[model samples]
Target: MAFVPAPGYDPAYDPPVPYITAIPGGLRPGMLFYIRGTLAKGYTRFRVDYATGQYEGSDIALHFNPRFDGRDRVIFNTFQNGAWGEEEKKKDTPFSSSRPFELVVQITQANYQITVDGKPYHEYSHHIPMDRVTWLNVKGDIVLQAASIIGCGVGSAGSKGGAVGIPGGLPPMVGPVCNRPAIPFTANIPGGMIPKRTLVVAGHISSGAKSFIINLKKYSSNDIPLHINSRMIKNVLIRNTFLNGVWGEEEKDIQNNPLQKGQFFDLSIRSGDQNFKVYVNGHCLFRFDNRIKNVQEIDTVEIQGDAELAYVFF
Candidate 1:
């Protein structure tokens, strides 16, 4: 089959492949569909499958597995108990870490072959019929260089018109909920609480000793602004070493000012995923992402001494 390069992808920078429509429907035994690519630190594999449509196997189609050997090769194999099943390895061939050039076979009968950097590296034996293997994929964060489906029936699996919906795609975490967009926090300053427009922190602020009492209120609600806070959150303490005492929409640079023993620092967070930075004693003490999003209310900013103020950029 001919392999067409995906649209919106830079073909020259990306590995090139023939369009999938040129290949014939049937082929002699021992044909292979080979893909070449580069791997990095992020997502690293791809899978193409016809099983989503009229195929007879599970929804999974074709897939690329990264080998976990000390070398950087990728693969998928059976695991026994809690460790790598030595006997389950496809071959005794040692894995390679040098930039790998690999190959895969889509056979009409028994196991298939996988070669890396042009060498016959591994073999896979499966019970599934090759006719049932219509889908294909190149998984992971590997940059696909080129691919060729040497056998037949290697075109796109029609469309996803009738596939059933799959759920539970997200993992666990108190991720920012889009529906509940607003989060409010209140600080109990030693003096009468003054409504400060912003609250900032440098690092882990110790509890008590003139700490900013930040509360996340109504954060669990769906009606709040997703960019701010979606719920009625309040009084969530944001500990810092230098906290500026100013508010408004203009961005102002904070002159490095000494922080008192009980005064927390003020951190300025820029829009997007910019780092939160604080200035203390004429020097930048710390900078990091607040990691929390959707903030609205700043009930108070308690300080042992006077707080330096500045406008917010975003």
Candidate 2:
């Protein structure tokens, strides 16, 4: 049976074996497919397929198959014209038995980048037209706890016109719809953050890490409306603004280091009429009064330094 997805939400969240669904925006550059699950104790092999439809014999653009019994390798290949392509195999297997796992795959113009946990895994270039692949099929020896697609940017999914039509509207947003972005990343705040815009920065602090910074600044000018700096050894989280290259007074009253080394953290910077509220793990951490009067003009957000960025949504 072809796996037709439910409207308004990705079917990856559905509870069932042989998890099947349609990618909200199809496979676009900058979108990400994330699967979090646990391999059964007697796991042998499993396949995650991105295909044209739910038909048993449809073409699959990316066939990510990991075998634990045969060769203990991860195989990446494609299916077209009812045949499989040459197998591209990796000797290492990051999946473990009786343990949780996280696999994030990022789509780009050139190729697909796969990452496990927080480290990069492999890169597979496109053989089929990326836009033609719209269905997501997952099956094999794993207890699928949660499967999701982040990074579905604006205007990419369920859009009408040409390549692939997203059946449901856009996938529901958990936040700003960002995929797995690499560290030292920078992107424009879509529609220029109006009041009540929530910006989230999430990642794991690297072991032996030093510091990291997340800043929201103007795209054309040098006015930094919000600057968040975290120092590990000094144990200080600094907040300030930089306008015309002149820095404002630093606010360092954060009592404890909210972010710990080797731990994952979810930090939020939400724009308000009078200030931007910052939260760590759902707790109100900092509130910076509106430094730049015109909030809609702050167009860019930048993250850099020591940390493995899991996700960034603006």
TM-score of each: 0.32, 0.60
What lDDT tens digits, residue by residue, belong to model 2 across residues 38-156?
88668899999989887799999999999998679999999999899999999899988855677888888999899898689999989889878878888988887556566443344
> What local distance difference test score does each model get?
0.31, 0.74
Residue lDDT tens for model 1, 1-314: 11122111111214432222212232224555545454545433333332222323334323335554344444444322333322332334332334534444545455665555445666556534445444443444455544444323222232222221111221111111111112222233222111111122222123332322222222223211101110112222223222232221322123332233323333322212233333332235334343334233222322221222211111
Give the residue spans of candidate 2 off by over 4 A.
1-21, 34-43, 53-59, 78-88, 92-132, 137-200, 218-223, 230-258, 266-272, 277-288, 310-314
Report clash pairs, candidate 2: 25-157, 151-179
